[model samples]
Structures are given as structure tokens and as C-alpha cells.
Target: MFFTLSYRKTFIGSFDKIGDAIDKLKQHQESYSAISSPRFRKSRSGEIIRIDYGSSDCYYLIEKGERDDRTIN
Candidate 1:
């Protein structure tokens, strides 16, 4: 059996899976040795995941209830 694979460049689709992020994590820095601005999400989902920006290695929010609840989601 033989198989050939080719790749095409395109826009990144929606981030719906953890496995979809296979690209190498790149880091950005400023001349003043300062961290970049942090991103604010509306939900607790992906809250624990630290972004490549700022120096907040251990900063996040903790939701009080389940994420699947009607009011939460």
C-alpha cells in the first residue's frame, strides 16, 4: 500500500478541541522586559490554560458551579 500527503495553508478554524493546537508555542517580548497584555474570556472554560502573553503563570478564576448548567453555559 502507498499513500501521499500534501498540505495547504489556510485560516485556522474554530478552537473546539485541545488536540487541534499542534503548532509550536511562540513567545513574544518587549524592549522594556514586560509581559504582554492578558486575554479576558467570558467563561471558565480554558481559564486554567495559561496564555503565551503576560507573566501570569498562576492567575485564573474559579467558577462556583457546573459549566453545563443553563446559566453557566
Candidate 2:
């Protein structure tokens, strides 16, 4: 059986740059493709950016003066 995931958020940046950045990440799925490891839920939600290290994770939070994000229009 094949399970699919729905992406509510859209990746707006350059595909090449995003791929390159994904390569630079240490613990993301892209970096672990070569390793045979159990796949499970990682991120449940993402706003602007997300990062993960060996044992640590981070998510972007909107603080004062910032409105979650900026509008391009």
C-alpha cells in the first residue's frame, strides 16, 4: 500500500537552492536517504523555516514586530 502526505504549505524559493540547503541540513530526510533507518513522523507543521540537528530541532516562531511572516504583495 502507498501512503501519501498532503503539503498545506508551499515551497516558494528556488528549487536548486532548496535542494542545496536540504543537502546542508544534518538530520533531515534528504540527508538520511543513504541510511536505512525507520521512517516516522518528523515535522507536523512548518511556517517559514525549520531545522534539525542530530538530537535537537527548531521551528520558527513569530515574535513581536513580526506578523508570522511578510507579504510579497
Candidate 3:
């Protein structure tokens, strides 16, 4: 699965699976300015799972890409 992970609108990486994606996000967990909870979303492109720290500061750790790799879609 081709994923577009980002932090502060900065491109992180393109993982192949949900597990890898989640792992990547966890690596940057402590970097968050605040702490609240996590969230998930399914869009027309792919799944977007993120964590909410506070304010508008959030990391879009998962964004399905259009690459024809090993993806759920």
C-alpha cells in the first residue's frame, strides 16, 4: 500500500501496509506539542489515521496514495 504520511504538512513516507504506517506514526508520537487522542478516517482515496495533539497541530500519518502497489484498494 502506497501511503503518504506527513507531519506539519511535511511529507513523511510512503508505507506499504497499515501496520507499517502506524509504526511510523508512533515513532513521532512524542514530538506532538499536545496530547488528546487518536482518530481515523476513510476517504475516496484511502484510509487516514491520525493523532490529535492540540490546536491545529496534527500529523496526517496515513493517506492512501494512487500508486499501484500493495494496497487495500
- Per-candidate Cα lDDT values, in order, are 0.27, 0.30, 0.51
**Residue-level error in angstroms, candidate 1, position 2:** 36
Which candidate, 1 or 3, has the higher lDDT? 3
Q: Model 2: residues >4 Å from true position, as ranges?
A: 1-16, 27-46, 57-73
| Candidate 2 lDDT score at position 40 | 35
Which parts of model 1 have CA positions greater than 4 angstroms off?
1-13, 22-47, 52-73
Clashes of each: 0, 0, 1
Model 2, 1-73: lDDT tens digits are 0111123222222223444544434334444344345233234233334332223332211111222223311
- The list of candidate 3 runs beyond 4 A from truth reads 1-7, 31-47, 53-56, 66-73
Best model number under TM-score = 3
Query: Which whole-number lDDT from 0 to 100 does residue 30 have in model 2?
Result: 44
Q: Answer with 1 or 2, whichever has the higher TM-score.
A: 2
The TM-score, computed over Cα atoms with residue i paired to residue i, of candidate 3 is 0.47
For each candidate in turn, the TM-score is 0.18, 0.24, 0.47
Of the pair 2 and 3, which is ahead by lDDT?
3
Q: Which residue pairs show backbone clashes in model 3?
A: 1-70
Instruction: Estimate, for each residue in 1-73, the C-alpha lDDT of model 1 and write its tens digit.
Output: 1111112111122234433322222211233224455443322344434323343441323222223323221
